[model samples]
Target: MSASLREEMELIEKHEEILGERAELLEQMESRREQLKLQRKQQVKEGEAARRRNATLLQDLQKIEDCLRGRQLPPPTILALETKYWASVEESIPAWEHFLQGKGPHPTDGPGQPSRRAKQQLKTHKETTKKTTNDQGLPPRPKPRTAR
Candidate 1:
């Protein structure tokens, strides 16, 4: 064979080897791309599942709040408990007043400061008492005894 022909044949063989290496590299790249695509799809699925779980938790929280409100009673029960509490408080008032010598709520206020409704009732009672006394041939009430 001539040297020129042999050089040409060697170049052809080198080109073929480069083409084979390129094919292998391309196959590796394609496999890596497929793996990456599958990993991204799994990540997206996990994210969607987390979002659904959060939504379920939010719904459960709302249900719990609703149940709590449903179980709550009105102010009347609280008021009744308060009244009992105040009666207990009232029991302590006299002893406290004795200890404090009629100072503060035990002595001065003494639960005597009436609520608006109670004061209105008292005013009506006083007016009725005055009217009945006037109708009778009786003097007006002697200085009314201060309620204890």
Candidate 2:
């Protein structure tokens, strides 16, 4: 009878160990399930962000295409160039006013208006400067040389 009792006690301990192992396995499975759920949620959020960004880009591209399709720009015209030059001059009114306040020459005619002879001399001077630079492979002078 004592031997039978010892065998029953050993069986009880073995069953207890098995139960403990099963409980540990269940805990590990629960942790893994929670990790998988979080990963899935993050993946869903990233997909939603990508969709919104794609939609915004598509809307912007469509607006740009619509603008392009709406108007045909006029061909290049002499009037356009003259208008642009006049606009530049109009925008420089402050600078021109400042110059007028000074004792220096008018801004419209920078320095004195070159005479025909002076203009011819300047053209020749530019030609000579260009040739010298081409021959010497050096940069042109910062200031044009004036006759003494």
Candidate 3:
């Protein structure tokens, strides 16, 4: 072949090599893109599973809260119990004070324990309360509790 013809052929061969390299690069890029797409799909699936798990946990928590609420006492019931406890403390105070004194319940009464002496005082107080109420022609007071 002539010199010019040889140079032209060499140039064409080089061009074809570059085009093949470019095609290979494009194929590699397409493969990588498919792999990335698969990774993204997996991630999306995992996210959906997590979301479902969270929803289930939230439902369980809500059920637990509902059960706790059901078990809780109403405000009125709590208040009533507190009132009764304090009332018993108030009722026992006078007997406690009398016992603390050296004189005890009275000169005639023995040095009785605070509880027994308090019961005696309460009986007298109740009878006197009934007599006064009857004398005044009013309804009697509510019966008081002596103990907790």
lDDT of 2 by residue, 50-142 (tens): 999999999999999999999887667966998899999899887678767874445555455854556778999999998987879766679
Candidate with the greatest TM-score versus the true structure: 3
* lDDT to native, each model: 0.84, 0.87, 0.86
What would the per-residue lDDT of candidate 1 be over residues 65-119, giving only the tens digit for each residue? 9999889576898889988999999888776767477333333334657545566
TM-score of each: 0.43, 0.45, 0.46
Error of 3 at 109 (Å): 43
- The predictions' CA RMSDs to the true structure, in order, are 22.9, 18.8, 23.0
* CA-RMSD of model 2: 18.8
Q: Any runs in candidate 2 off by more than 4 Å, and if so which? A: 71-148
Which residue pairs show backbone clashes in model 2?
Answer: none
For residues 1-148, what per-residue lDDT tens digits would candidate 3 score against the true structure? 6999999999999999999999999999999999999999999999999999999999999999999988967699888999999999998777767767854554334554455667788999999998887779766688988996
Predict model 2's lDDT versus the native: 0.87
Over all chains combined, what TM-score does candidate 2 have?
A: 0.45
- Candidate 1 local lDDT, residue 14: 100
